[model samples]
Target chain A: MSPYDLLPRFKAQYDANNQEFSISGVVRPQAIDELGPSIALLRDAIGRVRGVLYVNVRRLTQMNNAAFHAFSRIIIDACRARPDLKFVVITSSVVGWTSRKFGRLSGIEPNITVEEYDSEFYPGQGFLEEGGFVPILRSQTKMTWRHERAILPRHGMRQGIVMADICCGIGDFAVLVQKEFQPSRIVALDHSISSLNYARQVMREFDIRGIEYTYGDASEMLLDEAQFDLVTCRHSLQIFNRPELILKELYRICKPGGRVYITNEKNSHCLGEPRAESIRWTYNEVAKLFGHFEMDVELGPKSRRYLMEAGFEDIRVETFMVTNLDGDPQDFADVIAAWADVYAGEMATRRGDGAEFVARFRQGFQDHIFAALHPKGYAGWPIWVASGRRPQ
Target chain B: MGPVQHDLAGEPTFEPMIQIDMEIKGFVSAWRHCDYVSTYMARMISQNRSDSVRHSNLFSSAFNELLEVAFRTRHADGELACRVSRHGATDRIELTFPCVPEERQFYEEAVSQVAGTEARERYLNSVSGDLAPSREIVLLELAVDYNATLRVEEADGDVIRLVVDLPLEGLQH
Candidate 1:
């Protein structure tokens, strides 16, 4: 069958001027035999065309192997029909389905070219729902303590040292850092005045003095340059529209011999059977919903490289797993549920399929609760804290 | 009923069809039902003998792989029509789903890319288990001999259908 017959199935469009074709939507199992005939009819149409023949799959939400192999055949056939054809498979990193790394059949006559590209149809709105999340985050100090143990600097908080924390939401980790390090001046900054006020309330409730709250852009802070003894940002850099700008600002503000610290959650792993694996699967899939963003939050080992690019010295990266081992599993459940509740509202406004997502998030959150119980221990979604000294 | 015909693998085959339209979970559920029913029917045909169990397992595995793909990439909109028929002793199952034009184009190309060589080895190793299963993967894992075909066809109402054909009789050695 002519490959063009499949055009309606893929919503593909061909532009004769550029000799380019682009397709979008979920690739089903039977894409080939369906489209092949229609495309075969195009051999004459393409054979007469000039320059490179570019086929773009970057818009696809996902593709299965059977479908991919099928599509590959149509391309090879077209190339054979038109030896001058230069087929380029444009790929995207938005979803896990499109592999940035693809394969080549060593001796294929017409070598098809593969190009990397990205088109973000929807940006993640989860960060805007921080209000529902921060309260739960505030109550999860046990997690903070666990992460701090692995990430905290070896030396205790030196006296008379000033520290700056960017995007310091509710100051959970900032308070812990100040308590342990006993830094003389703790400047906690966030874009949200409400979040800063909440952090202040936490400080007052604990009688933990030393942290000074500031409401402003964490990326473009008003703080003087090269002043603070230590500059820190945890779990929020990934949400920033431009992380490189903030990273540069973090480096710019730190005192030359001082250190800069940043941390993020890498991924989640399950130890139990089907239930654990199921939750992990659901969680990982949901995480992909947030992957269309320009910058990634889960830097993991890559954080060290980012730090190095920022011209930091003596970079050290440590991974801390927040298993919530010591905390009540209910705490994890409550947090995830609240997290979903918060996300549901904002996401509804951003996505056309927002309602479906809201339902999935709620269901996934509930499944996570069930999985959390009787857990022999879950690992991963590792929180990485990478630190580096600003070169003297 | 026509006279019984045996294939080289010594297993009988039949053709049947089914349809589906769902988001991820619903699709998965529908597929689970399909897997259970299809394998059960196969067992009845093969007569639950000692060797039949092995064939049943292979059937379920291949079917499960196809279901995984549908779960991952199949859109919630439109109906998915599945048909299973006999090719010699093999059951040639064909699944058709509504899709967009570009998607149809993409799959045609993907099929061509893995035409010859060690397609199964490269495919199985490259794909992360986290996503949908590939039909080819099911056959490869079972070490079975099968020929798979995927194509797009025009349906009524200007809708396009993606049709996948998998010929399965039983595991080879």
Candidate 2:
């Protein structure tokens, strides 16, 4: 029988391959003897491991003195017995206490170390988090809100529901949602510390309340299961190499019969009237460029398939086009210009693209902007909106 | 009989946010009361913070340790009252409960011990060296780790109050 059978309120897993032992959930046993099975499992796991043993408590939301004393004994005993074996305790900032609590172990043993598990969250999206990119994110959200404000209600968003916006970059969308839908409680979470800081600053400046901007990794969030009535992750899945992991988390957080709403773009579908060919070619290359980095920029149409595979029911999908005429043509042109600077200047150069290819790539975004600003011209970007209900 | 109020000169005063009073027997009847009270109170107080999830997590952890200590040390008779208040960035939690002379002495000594420079070292040793749970460990953790200012006061009758002033919002950094 698994050691977990004895501890109903918690889970303990030992991964032999990685020499990692993870304990998650509320561990508040009345006595240390109650943790016998889990302690034995840890001792056995430590006996078989060599070099380094990773203890991951990122998701351990609560642990009382009994459990803490028991775990401390195991760590101290293991250090004294195996002088060469290093112990690395992985903690999460989301838990708030794991880092400070486990950090003391390093001082007790020379071989023991504690590290917060947050690094390299979004691989090719680093440029999007630069200080300069904050304004662009705001502009992008403003442009999209024109379409999404109307589209949200159709996707099961309404007043008085508890909502969560995962991968909420800069939180402009959450602010707009709070003002419009008036969700009873809104938790806007993102992996970027800079983004969350900016979001908090914006909230403070605007005196906006009720939206909680939290810093967390999207794939393994600290949020409890079945907590949110509606969970929305916008334009985020396509940026991750493994969109399925994010989908699983979104699915996990949504209450039964609640909807998970997501929006993604098919970059190749970007169109403009006067400079249509150039815009199409550049955007298609944008798709290919993101593909080279393991991201799927063309995951828009495949949202239905992903949702179905993730075990969602009553799936709904729709597509909307944000055009230069949506509000201000200047805003659309500015977005394209920033995209050109990032895609051609930074992303293409980093990809080792030749001068000729970079020039051509730059030309396309410039032309798209040209069309957006032209009096008779029209520029449009298509986004696919999809929502599915978690099985009741 | 009533909630304890503290007003110090030149010190920032707190505005009362929530108060809960219950029989000490009902509270210490189950260990889960520590969890329930801490989690529920943390959620209710953290709703307006910049990061409610993070604030709630930290608040619950610190508050749970306090409640756990109270559970292990309280006298059997009389009432237990928990009051939470706020002033700017700081949060104040006042836990008033029935305590005999010995129980009050334990709290007084523990609060003084945690105020020493070696409080963190004592906390580390308390958790690592001893097999049995220590009542002073939670107080040390709050004083040293959470950077909370803890005070013990003797109230009317057989009741004693533990006041914890935590600048929780600043601790997020």
Candidate 3:
């Protein structure tokens, strides 16, 4: 059965409650609040059943600590009242919370069971829902496609060398590659110490071994001449102030006959005027630097072209269009809220009514992003991904 | 894995469980109090534990090793001489630096650089009542004796301060 087949079952079970209920779910307080009374009633009913109370909450993009604590308290109280009853919680894996903290929380109660499902089922589900910018290119579909099409095949050949993933936010690709391909050694590199810590915790919780995690600037850290068979970077190249310098560093650390995989998201909005100029600068810098090496390039308006420009051989770019029926006004609001927190410091320093400006921008941006996914709105933005290999 | 032996003092000498737990606790505490110097120092000491069996009490041995490492390394010069004063169950660590006249001037410059105009003005206003016209007259009196070097360079009439290399000897533990 598809992972989503359980959603209706969860809804049906949740709807059948008639008492004060405590609902323990991941990444959504607002949605829980909307369904509060029904949830409370369900808790009361579940208290009487003497059977296990399993709650499967999906599509939560963000939640805060207070909300999480409140959710935990609800479950604790329910368990306290019904010692015979077991509480099972299934969370979506979109925001990368399958770490030691989550594991500890899952095992908090002896009778409680907590399980985390991956991005395939929980796209756009996380705690940073409304305030942070979820990169348009790092969507679940795009990441899965990249892994299935490129990462797995390359590493599955019993390659003796390790794979270095630079600027690996949350270390999803690194962890997935290690698990699926079983590389000799995997080094997950990210600048943020917090991200590396989280990645380490995830690795520990999942019992994933043979991976070394480091926190440092990729350019500074890649100064070591140790060559790797594969160097993969996805959705992280855009933020670098010096893409060419980084590309040179990538080439320096890659072994002879090794391949450097670069993936990025391209949209008309990002490629217009100032942003377009920035993209052009990076593209030109990459072209010049990679020209010295045995390289190939692919260019498309979507994911395909961005990879091609980075000098990969046997170029292939595919656009995967994803549509979510759950793209409601609430989802838009959540995205806006998440983006606000991220841009709060920057927005505060700017002139004019920053809150109002952000609110409007978020609403408009949400409408635009969802328009493509919605039949009634504009077609979803085309996600372009391309791959090429370095010649031996 | 043999009979977990204890020392004559009744302390677990070869208890792997106790050793691993101590190590894990040290690691966890390092992550917990990552912002504090003492916690970071503790973490550094914990990380130095190798498979070699040694004949020293854990705390004092760790402290001595750390001291040796700090003395030998570049971080020693930057080491703030921390005095640990205990009161009942609580311990307070006080760090004091001796400020020479040149170092004072450099400190003032650094403070000014950080505070900017508005903050400096506010600070001056707050301390206006304590200001005396000839208070800055004594130079030698303001000089302080400290182990760390206070390097100062003149930059367009501004004092630019630099911290000298520190010996990282005390971290050996």
Return the top candidate by DockQ. 2
Winning model by lDDT: 2
* Cα lDDT tens digits for candidate 3, A1-392: 44532332122235445322323322222224634564465655665665766555433322322233445566666677678777666553322222212333444567777665432221111222323333421344233454355534542224466778876766777766665668886666665544555666777799777776654345434223446777776554544444555565565666656766665544332211212343343334333222222121222243344434555456555544322332443343343234334333333223233656445443444444444334454322234444445555
Q: Judged by TM-score, which candidate is best?
A: 2
List chain A TM-scores, every candidate, in order.
Answer: 0.61, 0.92, 0.47
User: Which candidate model has the greater lDDT, 1 or 3?
Assistant: 1
lDDT of 1 by residue, A79-196 (tens): 6666766666676432222433233421243357765453321133335435566768765565657657545664223657888888776777787777667778777776554566
Lowest-lDDT window of 10 residues in candidate 3 chain A? A119-128
Q: Pick the winner on lDDT between candidates 2 and 3.
A: 2
Q: After superposition on all CA atoms, how large is the RMSD of candidate 2?
A: 3.0
In model 2, which regions exceed 4 Å deviation? A1-8, B1-4
For model 1, the stretches where C-alpha displacement exceeds 4 angstroms are: A1-131, A155-159, A268-274, A293-295, A354-361, A375-380, B1-173
Q: What would the TM-scores of all predictions be?
A: 0.44, 0.94, 0.38
Interface C-alpha root-mean-square deviation, candidates in order? 20.9, 1.4, 21.3
Using DockQ as the measure, what is the rank order of every candidate, best first? 2, 1, 3
* Candidate 1 lDDT for residue A325: 55
Q: What is the DockQ of candidate 3?
A: 0.01
Share of reference contacts found in each model = 0.02, 0.69, 0.00
What's the CA RMSD for each of the models? 24.4, 3.0, 26.9
The DockQ-based CAPRI class assigned to model 3 is: incorrect
DockQ, candidate no. 2 = 0.70
